[model samples]
Target: MAKSLLFIPDISGFTKFVQTTEVAHSQHVIAELLEVLIEANTEELQLAEVEGDALFFYREGELLSQEKLLAQIENMFTAFTGHLKLLEKNRICPCKACATAPKLELKIVAHCGDIEFLEVQGNRKPFGKQVIEAHRLLKNSVESDNYVLISKELSSDIELPIYYYSKVFRFKQGKDTYDQKEVEYIYSIIDSNKLNISEYSKAKEVVFDKPPGIVFDRNFAIPAESLLEYITNLSYRHLWVHGVDKFEYTENEVTRLGSEHICVINNKHLNFVAVKKKVKPGKYVYGEMTRSIPIADTLYQFYTISPISENSCSLKIELYWETKSILKKLLITLFAKKVLMKNTKTGLDLLFKLTEDSRSIPSSK
Candidate 1:
């Protein structure tokens, strides 16, 4: 029988990241990275399981050629770092999870050997000594967190050289003893600059020439970052924003620039995309734009949070609308503006009350 391949791409620093930052946001960040790595798989490897911060994949019949295997590793690293860069550049949240996400790293381990299969309640999985060895190799004496390690057995089988040097990879020999047995491997520390990361869409920062048509301000007895999260996180929208039949968004995704959500009201879907604008240095802003409102061709709403003290902040809500039709403009000037102001004020009042009531509740770490 042909040898099988065992591949694992683990997110380094995940434990520290989750323990030190906001739990919900950190989980979202890790989930996004894991999905990115899974999408980067080009060799058609079977996904065995998602082992928390890592993914276990196997190829049953054959191992990829040395060149193809190296390319696959590089592709995953590129995709992983590219997304970290995107998060760093496009983030709008001031929370620690969003601010420090770029500090995360990735390491991959690859091994090859003949494997046995076991069926567990209609699920087939690879098993045997090879799987154990592959996982043990993850605890090697590698100096860096960003790297690729190929077991000596697999490297020899695929004809990968001991001192393989490439633009992005420079392999060095390493070994460690596990369970009274020695395992050898070749490792390469990946340089982010050496890889060609793909480009992503940037956050759109719109410039406005006129003042907002409606503006309201309220002071909250919460920190600025916490207030920002409560407003930007669509999951909490239903509790504070009334008259919306439903709120739809990517539940596992962190709210960032270009992120979109839908507000279903009276059977009509209003699509809103996250946006940003210039604000004072000490203030944080979250803005959204929608074209679904009938009174105006375009509508924009911005929430600016300013820290007053360590435990208190003030929120300023601004509304802006634009239309080319004279009738629509007259209607907004005469009728819609008042209605918008009333609804916005009511929402803010509800939001204020919700925050006060939930102040004693322990938030997820």
Candidate 2:
């Protein structure tokens, strides 16, 4: 039983923020906040889960000291508020101004509690009342300026100062009213360098952890929508050939290139593996090639991939029914893919050189 402690910050009414503005209007603000969250999580925390409005952070079981929790929440609040100010200065959202917008004030609640980690079906499942109660304390608190609250259960467990706020209110809960008591915290400026997760999410830096499988998502730098018009009239097929006949694809039928077959070849602990799909216009697909490998259930094809770069992309070649009986299992395993690691790098290295100016798609005549 490995003991545990966690911090969960629930940004109030998150669904309304993104939904309130138009896609064109909210794009920059949303991007900025996302950047801040990613930056903060990458810089400060070990980075757990990023749900819609809530975030979960996990620390080493032994490192759950009161001082650390205070520092974590303080830094997060600092970053969150600072970014909020930047958004206000740019007139991103009139409602996010803390002085003027009461509804947009962020509520942060922190706590430490006991938990036992167990291995269930070869998966780690950590459960306890600590997290549930702490979550309740957060939801129970009213929104205020840096209004952070903690429960007595948490205050008793960890050594920290608690600002008492006894003015209690009742919240509607399925026709029942419940106690909404809270204990606040006095936060200071967050020192970014002291954060534990800051190094993991550098925008330009790539970290190699010998990933569970390969991930090839180059479309971030080169999109398929832009490339569609370029390939529309071209009759040439790009063949990602491997373990096949050569004269079968002849010159007039295709423009062949040597590219990496491994767009994204990684495994999730050798249990859950995924491949990203990049769908192009006029490309043939018997199935959704957006993020799928056709007929990949039972047999594993050793991937041959082209070198990946920032602005290059790969193509998806068609899969055939040559071995029908053996491919049944692959069909079943195709739907649960979590990441879409496309095979563009393989295409870039094999077909055309991706120069700096080669990023744009050709316009249709």
Candidate 3:
């Protein structure tokens, strides 16, 4: 029988990341990275399972050529690190989970051997001693969290050298014993700077020559980070902001600069894009812009949260609008401004009530 391939790409430091950071945001970050890795699968490798922080994959009755295997590893690594860079550059949340997400790393393990199969709950999966060995290889002495490890059997089958050296990879032989059986492998510590990471959209920082037309300031008894999450997370939009029929956004995605959402009000769609502007130090700011309002050519709303104490913060909401039509300006000044100010005050009142109620409940963490 021909030998089959076993592959696993594990997120290094995941346990520590989850344990040391905010749980909800950490989960979202890990989920996003896993999705990125899955999208980077160019070889059509069959996914067997998602083992918590790792993905179990297999290619039956075949081992990829040395070039193809190396390319696959590099592709996943590049995608993973590219996303980390994107998170770092576009982050808006001040929570520890979002702030430290760039520190996460990835490691992949590859092995080849004769395979067997097992059926569990109508799902067929790879089974046998080779599968165990492949998982065991993940615990080897690789000395680095970011690396690619190929078993001796796989290296021999693919004709990969023992001492391979490249700009991105510097491979060396290593061995470790599991169950009193010695297992040999070659690992290369990946240099993130050496990989050609794909580009991502940077945050769009806007500048306005004129001051905001309307501004409202309020104090909240919640941390700045918590208040920012309540404002930026679209899930909490309809609860506090009234008159919105529905909010449309990616449910599982973390809100970051350049993220977009649609607000359905009175059957009209208002498209908004997350944006940013310069703010003072020690302040967390989130801004959104839209041109979908009929009365104005452009509208921008910014929420700046400044920490007053460990458990208290001040929120300032600024509204800016522009229009070239004299009639539109007249409408904004006479009718639109009053309506917007009313809505803003109502929303802040509702948010403050919600935060007060939340404080009574004990934290799950």
Candidate 4:
């Protein structure tokens, strides 16, 4: 896997989008438009076709080293914009679909030095290391018509010296029963990796439904207060290791429940820290990875406690990426899905086992 990669999500149902609008076959036009954009982008970014509408790009073999890398990404985006201008929409006949449907948007995320190849093939190119995390970042991006958001890592490395401007927006997708996460979005799809078939396979298995939620009503009785705090605090500490550490709550929830909620924050490194800023958490929060994370599918969450009366405290959590598989769920007999199931079960066990040591302490305070 390449340490860094770029991601671009094109609209999937262009034909449907065109039917309601004045445009005739807007999808065709959009396809051609993107093809032209990529033509110019390839050389400008020093990128090679990875597959689909994504690519692997870097400045030769030399390390990006922050400032130089930022310049290259900005230049790539600038070239991309220039390509769009050359293929000016005004030059083409404005069809109903083009007029009605929102202008095409690209949510871009860029990162560096995290590349790896899961598989090697004679004809097929390899995947970059940052594919999973990069895509996760891309999904969290706000869908601006044409915007760019850099990761904290990228932001630190690249100065982004360009006439263009980029703003950081926190993104959360899915609501209600679905989980949401804080993310940054951008218009330029400048990460080092593009869409990969293997990634899609792994991603398709994500189970989006029945995630841990914003409000939890867990009840485990007859546990000692210190042990309870020990488990809760220990889990809280674990969540800080990976991103997704924002939290909010109204009342206690564990065994006894509480009167109000408490919010906890984490620093950039995912270490527990004070939340100087305030933000509400989603309803479906992902649970944390206490032990080793699952290999099949994975999700994460974080909760905080106020410790009022040492009885119960409120919990707030943020959901991380999720994986589900309709086919995998149905194909139990298939050897592949079976292996996936086993790994998933093992992953869940590892997560739960982290709390086993604290179980003897009795009522978790």
- Badly placed stretches (over 4 Å) of model 3 are 360-365
Model 3 scores what on Cα lDDT? Answer: 0.91
Candidate 3 pairs with clashing backbones: none
Q: Across residues 1-365, which tens digit of lDDT does each residue of candidate 3 receive?
A: 99999999999999999999888888889989999999999999999999989999999999999999999999999999999999999999877888899999999999999989999899999999999999989998778999999999999999999998888888899999999999999999999999998678997799999999999999988888788888888887887998999999977678999899999999999999999999999999999999999999999999999999988999999999989999999999899999999999999899888888886322211
Candidate 1 collision pairs: 23-365
TM-score winner between candidates 2 and 3: 3
Model 1: weakest 10-residue lDDT segment is 356-365
Clashes found in each candidate (C-alpha, N, C closer than 3 A): 1, 38, 0, 63
Q: What's model 3's lDDT at 39?
A: 96
Best by TM-score: 1
Question: In terms of lDDT, which candidate is stronger, 2 or 3?
Answer: 3
Please write out the lDDT profile of model 4 over residues 1-365, one tens digit for every residue.
Answer: 22344434233334455566534235444555455445635324444343343444443323355445444444444444443333342221223443443344443455544554443453333355444555455444243434344555554444433233333222222211113544332234332222111211111112344543233323232122332344343334333222335544311222111112233334422222111112234211112331122322443433332233333333333333344765533443345444433544443344334345444432211
TM-score of each: 0.96, 0.39, 0.95, 0.34
Q: What's the lDDT of the predicted structure labeled candidate 1?
A: 0.93
- What does candidate 2's lDDT look like per residue over 112-189, in tens digits? 567655666765544577666656665443434335555544555674444322222111111112355333333222
Q: Which stretches of candidate 4 lie over 4 Å from their true place?
A: 1-24, 42-94, 97-102, 118-121, 141-143, 158-365
Where's the lowest-lDDT run of ten residues in candidate 4?
196-205
Which residue runs does candidate 1 get wrong by more than 4 Å? 360-365
